[model samples]
Target: MNDRLLALKLFSRAGRVGNFSSAGRELGLSQPSASRLIAALEADVGAALFSRTTRAVTLTDAGATYLMRVEAILAALDEADHEARGTGELRGVVRVGTPISFALREIIPRLPAFMKQHPALKIELRVTDRYPDLVTEGIDVSIQFGALPDSSATARKLIRQPRILTASPDYLRERGTPAMPSDLAHHVVIISPAHPSPTFSFRKDGRVVSVRVDGQLAITINEGAIASAVVGLGIAASSESSARAELEAGELVRVLPDWDVGSMEVTAVFVSGKTIKPAARAFTDFLATELRN
Candidate 1:
C-alpha cells in the first residue's frame, strides 16, 4: 500500500475507534497486520504514535497531536476527489464550538447569512460555558477566548477584547466609584469564573497598581455574576468587548477609566493541521474576514 494512504486509514481508524483491534477490523485486516502497518508508518514518520498494551491501545501525546493533521489530509483528499467527480457544490456538516456569550452575542445572529451563502452545508453549533475537546467532540471549528496554554492545535486571533472593570449604576450610586485601583478594597468586588487566586491591575497617574480583590460571591465563567453586578450586587470584571453592548445600553458602567489593564486575545481555532476539513477552513476564513471588518 502507498504509505500515505496506509497511514491515513490506520490513523483514521485508530482515532475513531480508540482501539487497535476495532481499527484493524474496519480495514479488513488482522490485528497483527494492522499493527505491522502502523509500526511501519510510525517508522517512516519517526514518531511513536500509540502506547500499546495487551488490554488496550491509547494515543500517545504525539499520536493525539498527529491524529488531527492526518484527518485533515484525508479530508482534503476526499474533497478533491469529490470535486473532480463533479460534486456541484461544497456540501458537508461543519461543527462549530463557541463560548456561550460570543455564541449568543455574535456568531448565532450571523450564522443565517453563512447558511444562505452555502445552502448545501449543514451547520452544527455547540454553545457552552465549558470548553470541549475539539477532537473528542468532533468539532470542526471553535471560537475561543483568552490565551490558552500550549497546545499543538493552530489558533488565529479573531479580535482583541479588553478586560474592563465595571459595576451597576445602582451599585456605583450607593457604594461610590473607586477613583483608583487601591480604592477597590472598600467595594464589594464580584468575582466570577473564580480564579485559583484573584489578582487584578489598574493604573494610578500612569503607574500600574496591582490589587488582589476578594468577594463574597464566586461564580463560574459567563454566568450570572455580571447580571448580579448589573442588578447592584457588586463590582465585576469581564472582557470589555463582551460587556460593550451592555455598557452602551446603560446596564453597566465602566469604572477606573485611567487604568491600563490589558486585554486578552480572542481567537478562532480549528483542528486543521491534522484534520483540515474544507468546511472548517471555509468557516474560519469567513469568521476572520467578518470580524476584521
Candidate 2:
C-alpha cells in the first residue's frame, strides 16, 4: 500500500493546525475519514502518528519527523503541477499568420473547439493575402498554401491538396471543353491575381506537360475568382479540397480528370532557430491531424 499520498496530505494538514477537525475541513474530507487515512498511514509506517483525545489532537514524535519530509514532497508536487499545467493548458498568446481564404473557410470553424481545449489560451490570428516573413513578423506559426520556395524558415507539410483545373458547366457548354492542355489557349481563362506568376505542370497518361497560361479575367482575390468561375466566367485551377463542395454541388466540373494540375503542399512554417511555442505546436499538430482526416 502506498502511504505516501494519504500520509503526506494527512500529515501536512494535521501539522498545519495540529488538529484533525481543522485538517479534515481544509482537505474537504470528513473528520472520521481523514482520521482513518492517518491511522492507516501510521500502521504502514509502524509508528504512532498522532496523540488524540476527545478534546484535541497533537502530533507524535514520528509525526513531527514525517511532517518535514511530507511538506517538502507536497511543495515539489505542487511546483511540478504548475509547470505541467503551464504547458498542457496553453495559457499564453499564440500569434498565427495565415492566408485569408484558408483562415476564413478552414481554420476559423475549428477555432472554437481548439479554444475549448485550452480555455486559458488567447489566439491572435493574422489573415493576409500575401506571405509575411515569419521571423520579421513575429509570428509563432504560419499556415501557407502552395509550394514554399527558397524560404530560410523551417516548415513541414501539413496537408497535400491536389490542384484541379475546373470550369462551370455553362462555360464548358458555350466555349467548348479543352481536349488537351494545349487546347486551353482557345478558351477563356479566369486567373486569380492572388497568384500573379501562376504556371502549371500536369501529367497525363505518363506524359508531362507544362503550361504558362495567361487569362483575360484577372481578379485580385481568390474568393472573387472562385465566384466568377462558378458563374461560368472562365476556367481556373484550384486545390481540390477547396473546390470539393462546388464540384459536388454541380457548380463546377473538372476540366481534366486524367491530368494532375499539380498539388499544393500546404505547410506549417515557423521562424528559424526558435522553439515553436507550446500553443503553436499544439495547434499545428491539430491542423495536421484535421487535414489528414
Candidate 3:
C-alpha cells in the first residue's frame, strides 16, 4: 500500500513537472523505473494518466482529478503518521511567531541547543513585530510582548522585560548625561511612536515624573530605536532583553539608572482549541524555561 502511495505521489510530481525523467530524478528513480511504475498505476486505475508528447507530458483530464485526490490522501497519511508518533518524543514542525528583535537577539542564538536536544523536531520561525492573528496565520505559538489585549488564546507569562532608557556612550559624552528625568527634555530623544504618548514616565521614592521629550529621530520600531541609539543617534528607550548585549559591551549606557520606564510582559500565547500540536507545546515550554533562566 505504501509503495502504491509513493508511486501515486511520484505520478503527481510528474504531472506538475510535466516530465518523467525530472520527476523520477526527484524521487530517486530512473526514467525507465518511473515509467514502469506509472504504467502499472494506469493499469490499476484503468485509465491513461498522461498524454505523451515530444516536448512535454501533459496530465489527462482524469489524471488531473486523480492528482488532486492523491495529494489529499498523501497529506492525510503524513498527518496521521505525525500524530501516531509519540508526543513526548517531540517530532513535527513548530511554527513560532516572535518579535524581530527578540527572535534575532535572543531566541535565534539559543535555538541550536534546543534543536540538538530534540533532533526529531523541526522549527519554523516567523519573525515580525506586529501582533499576529494566530489562527488566521496558522501560527503554532507566538511570543508576544507587553500587555496582551483580550484574546481567545491561552497566555503564559514567560518573562517581564524592563524598558531601559539608553544612549550610546559617545552621545552621552557629547550631549552630557541627564541628571534627572526632566533634563531628558533638553537632550535629543529618539521616541517610539508605538507608545501611546511621547512622554516617558518614571517613579522613585514616592515621586512620579513624566517628561515629554522630542527629537529629530523618531523610530517606529523597537529594534530600529535600539540600532539608532547604538549608532549614537540619540537617547532611546528599549527593552533590556533587546539592549543587553550592547549594555554589557559598554557600547550603550543607561541614561537614568535610578528611573524606571516600566516593564513589559513577554507572554507565550498558544491556540485556544484542543488541536494544539504536541511539538508546539513542547517548544513553547522549552522557550519559557530557557528564556527565564
Candidate 4:
C-alpha cells in the first residue's frame, strides 16, 4: 500500500478503536509502527489528530472533522476498486450504534442471516441508549427512535413502531384489570426513566386522554421495564416490536387493546457528507426491509 493510503487507513482504525495499539493489531503492525504512521500523517496534515492520555486516546476536534472527509474518500476509493474488479463484494468494518433493548429483541436475533450474506464484513455493534457521536466514535450508522435531536448527520425513517401498554396476566389478575385510562392511576406502572413524566397519553374515541400512573419501580432501560412487566411487576408502555415475542407467547398481555399510546418512529442515522460504506448500506437496507415488512 502507498504511504498516504496506509496512513489514512491506520488513522481510521485508530479513530474507531480509540487505541493505537489495538488499531495496529488490526492492521498487522506494531504499536510503535502505528504511532509513527499516525505521527507522520499528523505532520503532513499539520495538526494533532489525537489527545493522548494514560487511559485512553480521544480524537481532537480537527481529527474528527478530518476523519469524516477521510471516510468519504476511502469509501469512494473502495467503490472504484469494486468497479474495477467487476465485483460488488463488500468488505470492511461497519460500526453500528443501537439501543440495547432493540438490539436484544430485534436486530441481534436477525444478525446471523445478515452476517451469512456478507461474509467479508465485520460488524461492531455498540448497544446504548445515549445518542452516539458519530464522527468521534467512528460509528458508521446508528438506529435511533422517537424525535431526533438537531444534528448534522442525515436520518431516514425506517419504521413507525406502534407502542402498546402491556402487563402480565398474573399482574392484571392480582391488581385487577384497568377498564379506563383513569383507572391506571390505581395500578402499578413500570416507567422508563427516559420518559420522566408520570403521565401517559392514549388516544380513544378520537380524543387523547392523559393518565397519571404511579409505580414503585422506575427502569432506566426498556429491557428492564419490559422484564418487570413480564414478571408481573407493573404495566409497561413499550414498542410492539420489542414486546412481540412476549405478547405472542402469553408472557405479557395488552393492557388496553382499544387505546393507542402513539407510535415510535425508528430512524437510520448516518454521518452527513461521508460516503456510506457498502456493508453499512447493505445492513441498513436489510433492516429497513425487514422492519417495514
Candidate 5:
C-alpha cells in the first residue's frame, strides 16, 4: 500500500479500536512505527488527529470529522478496485460488530458456508455486549437485538426472536412454578444489572403485566445469565433461539408458556452516511435468509 494510504488505514482502525498498539499489530507494524506514521500523517494534515492521554487515545472533534471523509475516500477506492478486478467477485475486508452471545449461537456457525461462497472477502468480527458506534468503529454492519432506539443509523429487520422465560427443572421443582405473572415477585430471578431491563413484561390474551425483578445472583452477560440459570440458579430471561439446544435437552423448561414475553427483534444495522460495500451487503443478505429459516 502507498505510505499515505497505509497511514490512513491505520488511523481509521486505531480510531475505532481506541488503541494504537493493537491496531499496529493488526496491520503488521510496531507501536513506535504506528505512532511515528500517525504523527507524520498529522503533520501532513496540519492538525492533531488524536488526543493522547495516559489512560486513553481519543479522536479530537476535527479528527472525528476528518475520519468520516477519509473513510469515504477509502471505501470508494475499494469499490473502484473491485470493479477493475473484473472477476465478478466480492473482494475486500468487512468489519462487523455483534454481541458475543448472538455471534456464537447464530452467526459463527454459519460463517463457514458464507466464507466458502465469497472466498475473496475478509471479515473482522468485533464482539461486544454494548451497542457499538457504527461510524466510530468503521463497522460495515452490525447485528443488533431487541428494540432499536431512534438513531442516525438505518436498520432492516432480519427476524423477530420470541423472548422466553426459562428455569431448570430442578429449580422449578424446588420453588414450585409460578402460576401467574405477578407470582414471579415471590421467586428468585436471574438478572443482568448492567442492562436496562430491570422490568420484564408479560402478555396473555390482551392482558399485559410488568414485573420488577430482583435477584441474589447477577450476571452482566446474557450468555452467563443463561448458563447460570442452567445450573438451577433462578428464572432467566432468554431468547428462544439462544436457549434452543438446552431446552431440547430437557435441562430447561419454559415458564408461564401461556403468557408471552414479547419479541426481541434481530436486525442488521448500518451507519447512514456510508455506502454499504458489496461484500458487506451480501453478508447481511445471507444472514437475513439464514435467520428467517
Candidate 6:
C-alpha cells in the first residue's frame, strides 16, 4: 500500500477496466483517493494517464505504453510471490478480449469452473464484435473468430467449427427451401459483415463452389444474424456454437444439410509479446481446451 506501488496498481487496473472508480473499489480505495493517486502518478511521469469524459475514462497514448511495462513489472512480482510461497496458483489480472457471441454462448458459461481452479487470478473479459487493438486496449489476450490476416502478433488456432447456411422454419415454408446451392441466388440471404463480402463458398464431394448472394439486411454481429434468421429475416451463415440453441428449438433449420460453407476458425492472439505472464497463459490454455469440448 506504498504510494508508488499503489499508483502502479491503480493505473494498471484503471487502464484495464477503463474506470478509475471500479479499479479503486477493487483495491479497497475510495474514488477520491484513486483520482488523487492517478493525478500524482501522471504528474510524476510528466504525462496525462487518462483522457476523462463524463461517461468513461480511456487510456492516453502514453498511458497505454506505460501500462505495458507496468503490467510486466507487476506480473514479475506476482511470479516472485508465487515462487516464494511455493504454490503453483496464478495471481494478478489478465485482460482478455473475446467476440460477444462466443463469450456469451461458450466462454462465460464455462468460466466459473476455470475460476474455481485459479481463484487468485482475475479475468477481465472484454466482449465486442470489432477486432480490437490489443496493445492500445491493454488486452493480454484476444479470442477471435474468422481469419486473422495481421501477422504482427502471436496467434494460436483453438478450434475450427463448420459454418452452415440456416433459415427459420417460417422463412423456409414461405420462400421454399433451396434444392441446390445454386438455388440460393434466388432466395433472400442475410449478409454478415464478419464475412468479407456477400460472397459465400460451399464444398461438396471434393467440388468447391462459391456463390454471391444479396440480402436486404446486413449484420455485423454473428448473434444478430442468427437472431434475424430466427425471426424469418433470411438465410444466414452461422456457426454451430452461435446458433445451437435456436437450431435445437427448431427456430432455425439448415438450408442445405449436405453442403458445407467451409469453416470458421477461432484463434487466440497473445499481446504480451515473446514472454507471456503465467495467469494469461493459463487462461488461454483453459479457453483452448474448454472451447474444443
| Model 5 lDDT per residue over 1-293, tens place | 88899999899888888889988887899999999999999999999899999877999998999989998898888788778977857876888988878888999999999999879889999898788887656688988887665466788889988888889999999999989988888887887522346678889889889988777777777888778889999888878888888899999999999898887888889878677777788889999899878
Pairwise TM-score winner, candidates 3 and 4: 4
Report the number of the highest-lDDT candidate: 4
Model 4 residue pairs with clashes? none
lDDT of 3 by residue, 212-237 (tens): 88767877677898889999998877
Candidate 3 weakest lDDT stretch, 10 residues:
271-280
Q: What TM-score does model 1 achieve against the real structure?
A: 0.74
Against the true structure, candidate 2 reaches a TM-score of 0.67
lDDT of 2 by residue, 1-293 (tens): 25458657666767657777677775577888888888888888899878988877778888878776776675566446546766677765688998776787789988888999889888989888678766435577998887675477789889887777788999999999888887887776767734455456779778999776767888766767778889998887667766777889999999978887767788999866555566778899988888788
TM-score of 6: 0.79
Candidate lDDT values, in order: 0.75, 0.76, 0.81, 0.86, 0.85, 0.85
Looking at candidate 5, what is the lDDT of residue 239?
A: 81
How many clashing pairs per prediction, in order? 7, 0, 0, 0, 0, 0
| Top of the candidates by TM-score | 4
TM-score to native of every candidate shown: 0.74, 0.67, 0.70, 0.86, 0.85, 0.79
lDDT of 3: 0.81
Question: How do the residues 17-41 of candidate 1 rate in per-residue lDDT, one tens digit apiece?
Answer: 6776677775577888888888888
Q: Is candidate 2 or candidate 6 better by lDDT?
A: 6
Model 4 lDDT tens row, 151-246: 666888899988888999999999999988899999988878335468888898899899888967888788888889999999988788888889
Ranking 5 against 6 by TM-score, winner: 5
**Superior by lDDT: candidate 2 or candidate 4:** 4
Q: Name the runs in model 6 displaced over 4 angstroms.
A: 9-71, 193-196, 272-274
lDDT of 1 at 243: 75
